[model samples]
Target: MSRSRLMSSSSLSVHGLGKRYGEFVALAPTDLEVAAGEFLTLLGPSGSGKTTLLSLIAGLAAPDDGAIRIGGADVTYRPPYERDLGMVFQNYALFPHMTIEDNIAFPLKMRKVKGADAKKRAAEALELVRLPHVAKRFPRELSGGQQQRIALARCLVYRPSIILMDEPLGALDKKLREHMQLEIKRIHRELGTTIVYVTHDQEEAMTMSDRICLMNSGKIEQLGAPGDLYFRPRTVFVADFLGESNLLPAQVDRNEAGTLAVTLDGGAGSGQAIGNGADLAAGAKVTVMVRPQNITVRPAGEGSGRLKGRLTDIMVTGSLTKLYLEALAPGLPQLVAAYPTRTLSDDHSIGDVLELDWQAQDAVAIPAGQ
Candidate 1:
């Protein structure tokens, strides 16, 4: 699908992209269509090919096979210079010898944009990053954030439609890294430029991107809005990697009315079939996945289904409290519960016995996938 009609000059579409180093695959077959003015993040761990994919689109590295279209023009074989896209590297890569002004003006000068216009563009670039007064200083004179801004300014000076960022904020301290995330997001909104950002930080991707493309190995694991990925992960890997989860083994024994009768074990003793109009055959095995925050803890009471457990650990993490429990029964798995700290009546200590419960709606059965 071409984004030409909907995207401005900054929109991009990629199809069947793959990269290989001899027999070793760096990236598998992939397709991604980024809307104009959208902030899409390529999120994955190291060796997941997120950087390789970004390089392929930026024309920094060629793909073994695929097609790349930017602003409706086929540029699969175009060199990086001809792609007309701005790129920011992890190291900033600012020219040490050039003044801030000259570094920002390099792209314009290379394109034969001369004299008064090039200098003016450079100055405006500096102003956009709020460092206009430092134009005369070289890269070494600026702080890490300033240098990064200058690199960003250099990339934006020529007004490229697409901007590819590879861990541009990775070098900064935590506070500064967070600050730059907002700045980058604000810049993208203001320019309405298509941005393809790469990062291994889940929080960063969730906080800054309009959508996230989660990759594993050399292929895409899942792609969706951040919220969708958070709430409805499709696989065990997706469930475990995106955030904390408690996976319980469940077996479907029967379907009555709209609910399923799932026999759950390993701290999932009170398992009940839960879903809207779900129908499944008996004797089917599925994994019941639940997030920690969804489970509630209380003292043992009269209930048809509840597990007895000893509080093995209590971790008070400011906003929330994490409770790790060891089930008394052998067939039950160890139970983990996370809830708002304020919800607990008494401060829980190690060795305290507690009851764990949850609504069926809070859990989902993940059928095996091919």
Candidate 2:
């Protein structure tokens, strides 16, 4: 099906939204636009105000300042019941006294839907989550994954245009959580619902979101697609938070052709700056972040030997190995690289000095204090 066919007719807009608790600011005056059917993830650590922003949108809490619009209609002062939103929580929030059918039909009841029509909607919703045969079961009789699906079905039964999910899969184990990720993607594609999801897990955000709004200290740090945020981070906080990072201080040498050249601090290495384009003057202090998987370890002097460090540790995890290398001089932070376990050289061992290399374009350089 065409994407537009699956998308809602309206978008969610937050205009200068602000919230405060006593002397502490929970959310700064901020504006954001979530396109219809877009899956946007609010990503950050606890206490970062992501939840506070979500609450304001859900009308669970009134914003101290700003207006929220659903498809261009103002809803800032509206009550939760009037906002037309579907919510899924970390806890299943299922009623133990109710059967699966009753739980799914509760929202329709509130909307005054009953009798055959309500039952039909409940059945369709149960089948939407692939639990068509579970209507006769009670919440206590279902597994965690099944109960979570029931919660999802309950949320979908009413067909709200906007869905807000606050760590809905957080209660599941890793394997099941992963499985549900694909399921959620499938559901989202089929329904064309505009989903605003919140999670602290970077991997989950990257896997499921069309765009990620990374938050820090109660503010948005960066907003972009997963690969753009991962490969071309604009700030040090963004670089370190999104994934594994090898951050090294560096000085700009010059811009060569379309690429900028830089000298690594502590004699780490010198290479062309690829995707990062923070304007910097010569000798400006900047930090370059490289992912562990990008760095290659080779026997010292075997290749370019651009930088040499002593192998200090080897951490093996099934198919991959984490190799730690530190500079010969004291005080330099160790470099961590990921290598395929099957291809690791038997000749190399801890205490063996090795040359570490990475494609210049693979590193993202950010200005100091960014």
**Which prediction has the highest lDDT against the true structure?**
2
| Candidate 2 TM-score versus the reference | 0.95
TM-score leader: 2
lDDT of 1: 0.81
User: Candidate 1: where is the Cα deviation over 4 Å?
Assistant: 1-8, 253-261, 272-281, 302-308, 329-334, 341-346
| Clashing residue pairs in candidate 2 (N, C-alpha, C atoms within 3 angstroms) | 6-192
Report the lDDT tens digits of candidate 2 across residue range 1-370: 3434323535999988999999999999988899988999999999888999999999999999999999889999999888889999999999899999999999899899867999988888887889999899999999999999999989988888899999999999999999899999999988889999999999999999999999988789898999999999999889989988888878888866536678877766676666366667677787878899998788988856666789888888778888888876444577888877875455679899888788878887788889
lDDT of each: 0.81, 0.86
* lDDT tens digits, residue span 1-370, model 1: 1233212456799899999999889999899999978899999999999999999998988888889999889999999989878889888888899988999999889999987999987887777778889999988999999899999999988888888999999999989999899888877766677899999998899999999999999999889999777766766677778878877777776766646667776544656535322345677776667788987777666344455678998887878888898877666667788977785454777898787666766776665441
Worst 10 residues of 2 by lDDT: 1-10
Question: Would you estimate the TM-scores of all the predictions?
Answer: 0.88, 0.95
